[model samples]
Target: MIRKLALITPWPDQRTGIADYAFDLAHGLADVGIELDVFTTCTKPSRTISGVRIQDIDKFPGTFAFDQTVYQMGNCSTFHGEQLPVLFENPGIVHLHDPALHHLIAFFLYRDDTQDYYRVLRAWYGARVAERVQTFNELNNQGFWDSPHVTEVPFFDPVLEHATGCIVHSAYAQQAVHSRVPNLHIRQVRQAYRNMQPPAKYNDGEVLQLGAFGMVQQHKHVDVIIEAVKRCNAEGKRVHLHVAGALESVCKDLPDLAKSLGIENDITFHGRLSEEEFLYWMNNVDICVSLRFPTMGETSAVVSRALQLGLPTIVNNVGWYAELPSCVTKLPTEHDEMLKQLVAQLQRVSTNGEQLAQWRAQCRRYAQTTGSFEQTIQDYVRTLACFRTSAMAA
Candidate 1:
């Protein structure tokens, strides 16, 4: 019997991370001949993407509008729109990127009377808004794996049990699902190695070029990178920092940041990048840096992209990043030593391409072993096969 699988990613393409995950996983599932339909929300007038059949989720009720998909395409409520359909249709498995906290919060804050966000809001202002916002706020505040509504809500169980199985990227994520309902036959997957080409790595004496992606979100620690670069430059080090992604809310602040550090010329803020521009910075960048300041240790798909390109990356010591790269220098406490390691890595990457090549090979090998398109598709297919067998028996 032919089995059908539905992967629900509740965000638009440009929102990226899980959305890119949904796309890549869909391709992987399709590579293994699994019948799958990708349901996710997109805002940029419905367009069909390569690999899987994309079902465009309506944006009439968009609450997460301050978004610009920096690394890749935009993503929205494809999962949310298709959630009920997934339940009734009963696909073999339904892989959630994570719980709907981002959606819930976006709906609470962005979904208010100011614009399209407010229309879908169940409560606004006074006690009702306070109560509704409080619930979502608590979810964010408390973090995942331990939430009141996780299992208290019945919808989770059917999705966990009867819906084939679940797939998550990290141990923390897997644990969160298990916490909602114990012993879920879940597959703990990591972020996939992207399909990209590496840039020519740079050296010690050459200008140390650093590329930082994502918006200037307060939580992302973009400022910390600037400060570190400034310190490096102050000590007669040639450092150039390039930032990609949207500057919607952060443009004014970005220039001021450089000016305040007196390194405005040292840093170039590329407002936002198209596919080509983004890749240019990514491929040419001497060091790909992502400073995630204690933000739940979630792994970055962007880092995966860099790995695919064979660009050496430097990320804050988060859950899997330490393990992701064979050669990684942890975020430095002392400015002098940190700069020394940073320069050393750049030299090794540039002069010692052979060593870097070995690490890159490891990256490719790991992707082939654990993250290949075939692995993704086959697992998804197997999950669906099980779901079909059980459903038909019922």
Candidate 2:
């Protein structure tokens, strides 16, 4: 019964992972004969899909006339701030990209008013969390925004208050949303990726090539990966790491850390790569060390990309990463155990050529079977149709 669809997300040229995801989903939806109006915060979208009409979200009408409206909600305030008001006025199916929206709400909703922020926290998270926030504010007044209070807590109740239904990409995210807002309609859809064929053969060079992709932030555990690579070298295995992704101010210490560990030459930090450049490096790497810890209940697009490309990926045994298939190498949660696991993994993949080949094959098979773009398009259409039918009845 769904005819026309309205999609709200950050468009390309914004340089965010969600932007890229929206771009691909828009194209896939258009290909399936769906009439689409893609709304974004960007005044001028740098790229466009052939049958999809891209427009600024400000132009969205006051009336809720579309068959269904889908709002892509993530943890970035700059990208998702404007969409919140529209969501409140006309509730829609919100694609919850990150379960923890503490930073986004803290930065965008209550940035100017300190007291109001605490009041809202108390209302959403109870008095205990509010007291903790007050103590945190007193101790770290200079750097409270990026502190653990903002990063760890899930202050997402306000944003999801008006959402008619929710789409989450991981089991962790689905559970987080349902547990917090028990009555909300929620669906779990694995993040999709293009089905790519694995490389015929990995690099046969002496130095093992490792890659760590996505935003190089503190949570990514890139520093630990660097030390792991150094340990691998010490164990008589030559290893080199290639990091490709957005390198913001928070990641400035990574290069210096590499130098301190005496693995400067073994690692290269390529900041903010273009799509072509990113794919090029991904295709060439032997294994991906995309470790994440203290996760915000977010899924990894880099891990998806690595899987489809038939490249083995290494992730910590936590959050959504733990739910990934056996193709990925899951390290321990403890720091010391993780370091030992990473070193052992790198060494094993380097020497045990047969096991490495089996892992690469497994990755391609799993990636093609589970999270294809075609499945994503179908899931969206089906979910929208069901919601439309429910709306008509209610």
Candidate 3:
């Protein structure tokens, strides 16, 4: 039985999705009587959040005097920068948020220190992978960070090689990791949804509102949602797009794209909304569109939040989103067909009050029945026990 644990992650103050997840998990663990000490990149002195002690990463004792040390690993450098070094030096159970970790590993190998690039590549992927690493280095030097080819190869072996065990949010991620590293102990845990008050019944007025939350990125296909809304408006359907979260640098031109599509006036960009504002728009929206392509095999906190709020969601039928219950609308895979389907679905839901109400009720039921934070905490506790047993045996 794991009694005390050290959790390494970006805390709530960082304003990243992983940070929010870490804090939530910490709170849940604390509630279950598990002692937890959180370590983050923030250089502030130790503080208490939700009954958990949070300290700076630099202040972390080189070796934790706890039953287990879990590091929350993600692809973003902002969240992983300080945690990565600790992960490599003192490996522990890794909670992999994104299965596609090529970009993060590439950053460490090439950008951080070129000297270890070839050596680390050979160690993880054998001599054959050195050529691929060289090509990656050259392309990275040429400023092609967004190239799909960068993540074509799974470079997560480096992290997995050092991990005592691993935890992934979705079965898809669990399968992906198992296929790559079959012998490793991996647990599939569902991401917990935030508790939300039952929203007041939506009044489908003249204008139908569509919402997209989380960091606006190319893979999220905010552009597609904007295009679908434009088409719906052209077909005599009054539709508007409300986007939450700050526009990422890669997708900064989304406002321009909306302007070019002639739907700028109909779209509202609520940049980095507060919790109150986020829930306000989420509860008010007619439908939530959460689409992603070239998925990292990670679950969406935004989509989970929408489901918890009983808002009908439209997701792309790919990766973990494909596993969503039938209550949520799923867009087809093909680009043209996806846009067409999205436009049709938006039109149908906007005009048909009965269909919209049915979807809302079904989604709420699904969330209420299957999305329990208490269950998620129990799952974590069980999974952590396995790691403890393995460590004891070793």
Candidate 4:
């Protein structure tokens, strides 16, 4: 029975994956007749949807008159930090895009004072962890953000304690949230993506082209993918890699790494791409390689988009990616064997036209049958409506 909603999220103009996702979801919700108020920090709206009203987040007034406020949250501090006060002050349905929120929480709490950060950490995680803040900081300096303590410990309680409900995209995320906040209402919805026209006839060319999308980070294993491409070429297989994402961020050295390996010519870094350019590369590549290690129970929008477009994708068999359909080429988690497996798979798919076609058909079937944007929108409506009913009954 929800007629209207307030969506607190970064809008498409921000050019982040979460922003694009929220944009798509807003349009879907609006199409289903739900009046939506989109609260964003952007000075002007990027795109318009009939039933969605774009309002400056500064004008949020700390509360909403709508039935529910869906807050799109992720791991990035820059994008999600300012919204913490609103989330803490107004209880709403939190659409958690990433289960591990240590960095975001740390950045916000420790921005002004280190002592305040430790005090809050101790209050939420206890003395054992607060005392080891120095160690965590040292390890963080060594780029161990995905280590056991950071990824396993749920740093969400401080921010999500007041949330009325939560929606997660993967089973891994669902389990993580349920373990931390058992009493909170939780719903698992398949990540949403609209099916695009399937890519032009599968490329049967001799040289295999691979693409890696989204924010390129160490966890995404773009370096490993580069190594795999080098090895495949060395073994008499022609392979090229296309990387498109933020290059100025954590993995700025990827181009340098590619150069060091003498495969700079084989790899192309497209930096951050527009939506049209993203889809263009997705269609052009022979295969999409999206590998993640030490995952924070996060699902990839890139993988979802690839599958919906019937593009064969390769995923590492861990965390949320493990739950993907068999149509995707999966690589084992062990680093030693991973390269060999990837090289072998790339060689096989690039050389065999029949196998590639089967994977495409199967992936398209899964996307068409398992879940579509239409179904995802319906799931959101049903889940939101049920939240009110369940609260009343309780």
Clashing pairs in 4: none
Task: Name the better of 3 and 4 by TM-score.
Answer: 4
Q: Model 2: what TM-score? A: 0.92
Worst 10 residues of 1 by lDDT: 66-75
Per-residue lDDT tens digits of candidate 4, residues 1-394?
A: 8898889998877866888889889888898899889998766667878857898877785545888888899988778877788877677888999898877877766767878877888887789977776467766654224474566676887767867888899888888888888888889987876546565566667778899998888778898899998888777778899998886476888888888988899999998888889988998898899998878878899998888888889998987899888898889877878888988888887678787778778877876687678988999889887664222112
Error of 1 at 100 (Å): 7.8
In model 3, which runs have C-alpha deviations exceeding 4 angstroms? 44-50, 62-64, 112-119, 127-152, 197-200, 389-394
**Which parts of model 1 are misplaced by more than 4 Å?**
1-3, 10-14, 43-52, 56-92, 99-164, 197-205, 248-252, 332-394
Error of 3 at 149 (Å): 5.4
Off by over 4 Å in 2: 140-152, 200-203, 388-394
Kindly give the number of clashing pairs for every candidate.
22, 0, 0, 0
Query: What RMSD, rounded to one decimal, does every model reach?
Result: 8.6, 2.5, 2.8, 2.6
Could you give me the TM-score of model 3 versus the true structure? Answer: 0.90
Q: TM-score order of candidates, best first?
A: 2, 4, 3, 1
Query: Weakest 10 consecutive residues, lDDT, candidate 4?
Result: 385-394
lDDT, candidate 1, 1-394, per-residue tens: 3334444454334455565566565566555565555545554513344555555543222212211111111113333534444444443444554432333334333535433333333332235644554566456865222333432221233334443455555676566567755645566555563355444443434576788886656545667677777767776767788988776564459679889889999888887676568777777776677755444435676777776665557865545554564554456534455455555554555455576567556555543444444554555455444432232112
- Candidate 2 collision pairs: none
lDDT (Cα, 0-100) at 367 in candidate 1: 39
lDDT of each: 0.53, 0.81, 0.80, 0.81
Score every model by TM-score: 0.66, 0.92, 0.90, 0.92
